[model samples]
Target: MAHLLHIDSSPRGDRSHSRRLTREFVEAWQQTHPADTVTYRDVGRQPVPHVDEPWIVAAYAPPEQRTPELWEAIRVSDQLIDELIAADILVIGLPMYNFSVPSTFKAYLDQIVRVGRTFAIDPEDAEDPYKPLLLGKKMFVITARGSSGFGPGERYGHMNHQDPYLRVAFGFIGITDITFVHVENDEHSSESLAASIAAAQAQVAQLVAA
Candidate 1:
């Protein structure tokens, strides 16, 4: 059975659409794959710290050359990377904060996307240097937005950075098989919100069944 990693990045508790959708998705997933295991991380509530000088220094240093102080600096990063590598499937609840990911989620990303852990640098290839270490993983993202029309060819599609940024970031780490389920228009209309929710739920159900 496949192991799943579920992470929520919305600060809101009960009022978060992405959070609710992720919970629903996980529940449905468990019903279908009872033998599978899940690991949960609430990055929104218990946000990880942003990368600093010490973290950068430790990350670039070789494992053998790193002192205890350096190792300690990257301890949380090591743990986060371990969880990412262990999971075969990932489900993330993401809320769009000013057209991008929340700072908390961004911090988590900075921690996990390490050089030797998540990716490797290749000096031989001048055109492409970064080699992805994590492979054979699938990811599902549930995104919530205050406004609508972020899809391709839409009015605000050019302004949409959340989905594209996520795709590129995760794909950089070898998670090319990523799908997004979006719930939008919570600020303007309730009917639109409900419709989006329904569509997202249906997509989640279909994905879980498959």
Candidate 2:
């Protein structure tokens, strides 16, 4: 059975669309694969610490050479990385804030995406210096936005950075098999919001079954 890492990064509680969708997805996933294990993290509620000077030093320094203070600095990072590496499937719930991800989610990303842990740097290789170590992983992102038309060839496509940025960042760690389920038009009419929620629920059901 696969181990799933479920993360929600929406500050809102009951009002968060992405949070609800991800919860439904995980519940359906469990029903489909009852033997699968899941680990949950709420980065929005309990934000991970952002990278600092000591964190930078600790991350770059070899594990064997790191001092106790350096090790202490990277303790959280190590735990986050270990959690990430243990998962075969990742489900992330993200709500677009100010046209991008929430700062809390970004902070969690900064904590987990570490060199020599999630990725490796090979300066000796002239052609390819940075190498991704996390491979054979699948990711599903459920995103919520206030507005609509953020898809490809849409009016807001040019202004959309949420999905593309996620792709690039997750791909950097060798997770290229990524799928996104977006619930938009949240700021629109009640009918539109209901329709969006229904559509997202249907999509989640289909994805989980598949």
Give TM-scores for every candidate, taking all chains together and pairing residue i with residue i.
0.98, 0.98
Error of 1 at 52 (Å): 0.7
TM-score of 2: 0.98
In order, the Cα lDDT scores of the candidates are 0.94, 0.93
At residue 66, what lDDT does model 2 achieve?
Answer: 95
For model 2, residues 1-210, the per-residue Cα lDDT tens digits are 999999999989999999999999999999999999999999988899999999999999989999999999999999999999999999999998888899999999899888998989899998988899999999999999998998889999888889999999989989999999999889999899889889988999999999
Q: Cα deviation in Å at residue 102, candidate 2?
A: 0.3
Q: Which ten residues in a row have the lowest lDDT in candidate 1?
A: 184-193
Which regions of candidate 1 fall more than 4 Å away from where they truly are?
Answer: none
User: Which RMSD values do the candidates have, in order?
Assistant: 0.7, 0.8
lDDT of 1 by residue, 70-117 (tens): 999999999999999999999999999999999999999999999999
Error of 2 at 85 (Å): 0.4
